[model samples]
Target: MEVFLSICLGLGLSASSGFRVFLPMLIANIAAMSGWISPAESFAWLATWPAFFALLTATIAEIGGYYVPFIDNLLDTIATPAAIIAGTLLSTSFIQIDNPVLQWGLGLILGGGTAGMVQVGTGLLRLLSSKTTAGLGNPVVSTAENVASFGLSGLAIFLPIIAMVLVVLLILWLFRKIANLRKTK
Candidate 1:
């Protein structure tokens, strides 16, 4: 049960990374420091003050970058892969499987995959918004993503089961919407 919860938390936080790469890391650092969550032995560095401040700075820069018009799209090109790496790291941090091979396998497959899917969805959404609104609507989308990253990170730490449910629902909704868009095209 404890292991299950850890995976759920990891995946949930990983998915949140899709929206904003550093937000989940910041959340995890705070959680680890506050005793809300415990990282694996290999990831203990994340709980340090330096890591906390570094992630805080990165989080601010990432959020601000998304608010820039054309820069947001350009950043997406970079952020997608970064999010996957961050997601995998986030998952491995909380998960405690004994086998290193199995742990990293699950982290890359589940955590990285979830973050990639969500990042793709958001990138597409941002593209659509940019097209429809001449990039004027991107800040709103950026704001929403920021809120989502923060909310999902908190939920992932404190209520992982609920966060996983939300992630599933979000994926389903994205699939349905994509299918509908395809049908129209």
Candidate 2:
């Protein structure tokens, strides 16, 4: 039961990472620092000050970069792989398991997969926004993604089960959106 909840928490945070990589890490570090959550034994560093400060800096940079016009699209190309790594890391940090192989494998598959899906969905939306609005609508898209990242991270920490439900719904929505986009192309 505990493992399940923790995995749900990880998945929720991973989904948030899909929107913005560092924000979810920052939020999780804050959660750990505040004693709201406990990371896996090896991930104890996640609760430290250095990790917090580094993640803070990265988060701010990531958030600001998205508000820029062409740079946001460029960032998306880099972010897809980064989000997968972050998602896997964030997911693995919560799973309190004895078997290293199973833990990491699940983290890579479920967490990375979730983040990649959401990232692709957002990337497609940004492309559409760029084309339709001539980049004017990108900032709005960036802002919404940022807000969703924060909101999902919060829910992942405080209400993981509900967060997981929302993440699943988000996945479904992404699937539909991606399929429609492909059909249009």
Candidate 3:
């Protein structure tokens, strides 16, 4: 049950990574630091006070940076790697694994892959918003992203399966909207 829960949690965190890369990691860092969740021995580094502080600082900076008009788009360019790394870390940290290979493989496929997919989708959304809305509607998009990231992170930490379902639904909805737009064009 613990293993299943942890995997679900990892998947949830990975999905949250699609929205904002660091938000879920920051949440996990705080949770682990506060002893709400216990990570595996290999991931004990995340529990350190220094790591927590660093992640907190990074999280705040990332949030603040996203509110800047053109700067937000620039940040998205770099956020891809951040999202993937954060996804892998969050997913791999909680799972107990004796073999390094298995842990890494799962982390790459589930964590990194999920984050990358979400990040790509979000980048496209921002691009389309910027093109059609002239960046005027970016704040609304940003706000939604922030909320989704925060809410999904919390859900991932607590109830992962539901988070996964939400991620699936979100992806399908986005895909359908995009297809409809292409057809209209």
Candidate 4:
């Protein structure tokens, strides 16, 4: 049961990484520190005091920067790759599998790949909005991302399975919208 819950948390956190990378990490790190979640032994490093401080700072900085006008879009440009790496690392960090190969494979594929896909999808929306609305739609995008980040972070620590299901739904929805846009063009 513990393992299952942890995996679910990992999936939820990975999904959240798509919206705001550091937000979920900060949440998870705090949870682990408080013993709300029991990460794998290897992830014991996350419970350290310094890790907590770093994530807290990063989370605050990232979210605050996203509230700015043009700066939000610029952050997304660089955040894309960083989100992918964070997603994978966070997923694998909580996983405690005896099989080394399986751990890294799933970390990169499902964790990193899913986060990267979602990040790129959101970035494309921002790009389209910038091109069409002249960047006026950025506030809406930023707000939605903040809601998603908070929602997924909470779900990751509490109802992880539900969060994973939501991630799948979000992916499908994004894909459909992207497809419709392509067809219209």
lDDT per residue as tens, model 2, 33-113: 999999999899999999999999999999999998999999999999999999999999997777989999988998999
Report the candidate with higher TM-score, 1 versus 3: 1
Instruction: Answer with 3 or 4, whichever has the higher TM-score.
Output: 4
Q: Compared to the true structure, candidate 4 yields what TM-score?
A: 0.92
Candidate 4 worst ten-residue window by lDDT: 2-11
Q: Each candidate's TM vs. the true structure?
A: 0.97, 0.98, 0.91, 0.92
For candidate 4, list the clashing residue pairs, or say none. Answer: none
Query: Cα lDDT of model 1 overall?
Result: 0.94
Candidate 1, backbone clash total? 0
Off by over 4 Å in 3: 174-185
**1-185, model 3: which lDDT tens digit per residue?**
77777877887888788888778888888888888888788788888888878888888898888888878899899998889888888888876566778887888788888888788788888888889888888888888889999999898877777987887787787778878978999
Worst 10 residues of 1 by lDDT: 91-100
For candidate 3, list the clashing residue pairs, or say none. Answer: none
Q: List the residue pairs that clash in candidate 2.
A: none
- Per-model lDDT: 0.94, 0.94, 0.83, 0.83
**Model 1 reaches what TM-score against the true structure?**
0.97
